[model samples]
Target: MLRRVLVELRRPQTPAGLAARLGVEREVLEAMLASLERRGYAGLAYPESPTCGVSCRACSLKNLCPAAASEAPQSPPVWRLTALGEQFVESAAEGG
Candidate 1:
């Protein structure tokens, strides 16, 4: 789950984006995201509505996320990697 979140964190993604990337249900993705948040592995950032391309707007299910709507739209979605998360990823990559 952490691995998946890290990949998603590399980009600004909605629940749908996670679902699609992870090949799981949106609810499952949401639960995993929540778990990551509880473990202090990730965060959410909502950016201003983009004026570029219709496809970009359709890329995420932002409308379904309450946290996304409550935050300032001007702020972009930022997934901060905690030190622990980074360490874990590095260790896993090194097969430690």
Candidate 2:
């Protein structure tokens, strides 16, 4: 399941979108995301700046964006895999 989460996180995604994709509750998914973050497997997509560059509706990833994560999102952070996470995914793919 952790591997699956990392795989899905190849692209930026929100807690709610990820939860729905994984068939888990938002709270449960957040816990999992936290764990991955602690291990350097996942992290914020826009750590240096805010991600809301364009209006929500015009964004290509709107469906996976923080704004779409909830009815009301105050610049919710989007999650993505870190370098370590990419290594993990690569190793997993190679069955290492």
- The TM-score leader among the candidates is 2
Error of 2 at 72 (Å): 17
Can you give the TM-score per candidate against the true fold? 0.54, 0.71
lDDT of 1 by residue, 1-96 (tens): 658676555445666766777888877877777787788665555434322112324535445443344445443233434445556667777998
Error of 2 at 34 (Å): 0.6
Taking all chains together, the TM-score of candidate 1 against the true structure is 0.54
Candidate 2, 1-96: lDDT as tens digits: 888899998777878888899999998899999999888788766423233344445655556645444443235667877778878999989998
Any residue pairs clashing in model 2, and if so which? none
lDDT (C-alpha) at residue 56 in model 1: 25
> Candidate 2: where is the Cα deviation over 4 Å?
47-74
Best by lDDT: 2
Off by over 4 Å in 1: 46-80
